[model samples]
Target: MLRNIVLLLLLCLIYSLEASDSDKCVTVNVNNLNDLVLKTFRPKPCMTVNINGSGKMEILSSDKFKTPLSNTPLAQVRITGGTFSIDPNFFKQYRHSLDVVTLENNNIPKLGYHVFQDLILRQLELRSNNILFLSNPFYNCSIYNLDLKHNKIDHLSDITFSYTRLFHVNLANNSISIIEPHSFPDTVITIQLSHNLLSSIGQNIFSNLFNLVLLCLAHNRLEYINFEKSDLGKLEDLDLSFNSINNLNQAGFSSLRNLKRLNLRNNHIKSISATNLQTSKLKILDISFNFFINFPHASLPESLNVIYVFGNPWNCKCLFDIEDSFSGNVVSNTMDCKLSQIVNAPICISYGGLCVDDRNNTLINAFSKEVSLYSNDCRDLLQNVIFDYEH
Candidate 1:
């Protein structure tokens, strides 16, 4: 094991050195952008072009901002610092031999409608730009991964992402409130829409995405959900934690039959029904930190291997019953554990004494004392939470 670790460290060091040596940057300004194209921009192979103190980043413009490096093989381009306003046909010339493009930590007020039209890039990242609104920008591009997180985007117009080869799209950490119908195309596989202002979404917003798998809507203002309206039959992982959801349909994601993991923690759910899990393929479930008074009456899904249920006003009597049922033995342990963690366990048997239902709703302070769970995903007790923090 020590030898393996040493070998891995050596490989990491080699890779880091190679990566550091491959970067090529040129300090650019407005006046010298046109003059430095052939002389300083394209010589052999440039991995990255760092635009310092940017004003006009239209490097591939029509008149003077023509494609500078049509001969050299450029891998990536990152424009950082200052503010920029992109124009159409920005990258009209230098489209070949480009794999990734990033524009981060800049103040971009408006994105050119067809800046990346028909480009064959692999990844396009526009992070921390503080963009307020957006519409269908990409047109017939072969880009697969797109990142637009940490912006102030407030709305999503129809076909927000044009029909392209995009697979993974990240729109997290925005103040998005309105999402027009068919905003997302059917080609996307994963979409990150966490930390937004979505109180509700139209049923057909995700209707055409048949190949989507992972979807995150955590830290939103959603109160109700009817997944049956959403035709996401192939989704596997879903995150709905840290919301204001109080009403969930008992039919339980009629279209999410292939769902393996579900997170509904840190909400205001009163009671849940397990009848929907009978026909579904859920493996991990988290319903912690809610307003559950008693465990659901119906048995959990047989395919479930792990379930998280803690930090709620659970009736000790119900947990005892569930423990007896799960262990197939009599209930003996009545001491409530402050927090619980176990492997391959049924809905956890964390004790919290009698529930509000048992005491005729007199213990108002019991709800105030309910703990909040640390889990936001079913695969692990802790998630990265990068999408939850302020961006």
Candidate 2:
């Protein structure tokens, strides 16, 4: 009778490991289960399955799951550090019931095809997997937020993210160099492709993203961007900082009707006409750390609130001209730096660019001699450009 009692306790332990229940969910945790121990693992109406990829977790075969997982109403599953392949038939039951799937830290070098297709997941995070390729993985899924950061994906086919409705996507910090046109879904609101190797954008690449609000192409190898071609109508923020952009035209940003912030700091821009930035709703413009001989400050749009021009080779005559231009106009937040006449961004001048504030004290502060940012002549400007800012 004592021998029978020990066998009963062992059976209960295996049952709890394969199937357990709380106030809301029945769960199956495969923390440690071999094929021998798993044959006894009959699942019961479980809502969550946590496969931690620990202790001899091999490729998960649906036939080994004993009962048909094809009918299980799972709501959430976190499969981490596993050498598992996401087979479509394996998650046949979770097509409509799954809410979230997190598959990070798996050290996966490749994601098998047909990933999360036709799944109505609220959130899906496949970050830090060391993945090297992707195609139309989320083909027909209704994902709300998708995060695929820190991968080696280089090319995006036109149908890569062509799902039903994706709200936000972060493909930042990848080796993406080629993106085909219409690669992004129109349902997306925010898309981040920063820190990539993109040198050019395909025609009509972002023209279809009518609902896109924020598009980040920062830290790339783009030499020129013709905003008149894409004309992102609903975009609010544009970050083209840290590139090789050289010039702009009058039709550069004219169609960006709802754009508010433009970050062009740390580029190769020389001069900017006020009409080039004549968007109807622009507020802040950061053209700091560039090569500018002059800025069209006299004709700045009334819709603009602030323009940051730090770390540029502004000619001394232009600095005096800006001071003279704003004195009569409706702009005087600081006595020296008239560009920062906007109330919130008062200390706009820093890392002095132009030389000679009409007093020859070119190496002191930001705007004026008392609150200066390095004012000097051509000799001082050339020395500073070579020594300080020409990274």
Top lDDT: which candidate number?
A: 1
lDDT accuracy of residue 9 in candidate 2: 100
lDDT of each: 0.65, 0.64
Residue range 22-52, candidate 2, lDDT tens digits: 2144455656323323533434443345555
TM-score of each: 0.77, 0.70
Colliding residue pairs in candidate 2: 355-376, 356-375, 356-376, 362-375, 365-372, 365-373, 366-372, 366-373
The runs of at least 3 residues in candidate 2 whose Cα sits more than 4 Å from the true structure, single-residue gaps closed, are: 1-72, 323-391
Over 4 Å off in model 1, which ranges?
Answer: 1-44, 51-70, 328-356, 359-391
Error of 1 at 255 (Å): 2.3
Q: What TM-score number comes out for model 1?
A: 0.77
lDDT of 1 by residue, 1-391 (tens): 9999999999999999876665655444443335445444534344334445436544335444334555556566676664656656666556676678888887776676777777787789999987775655687777778899999999887766766677788999999988777788887788899889999755677888888888898888988666666778878888888788887754256468788888887788877666555546877777766766677534666676656665455566675555555563222222133333433222332345543355223222433333323122332433322222111
Model 1: which ten-residue window has the lowest total lDDT? Answer: 382-391
TM-score of 2: 0.70
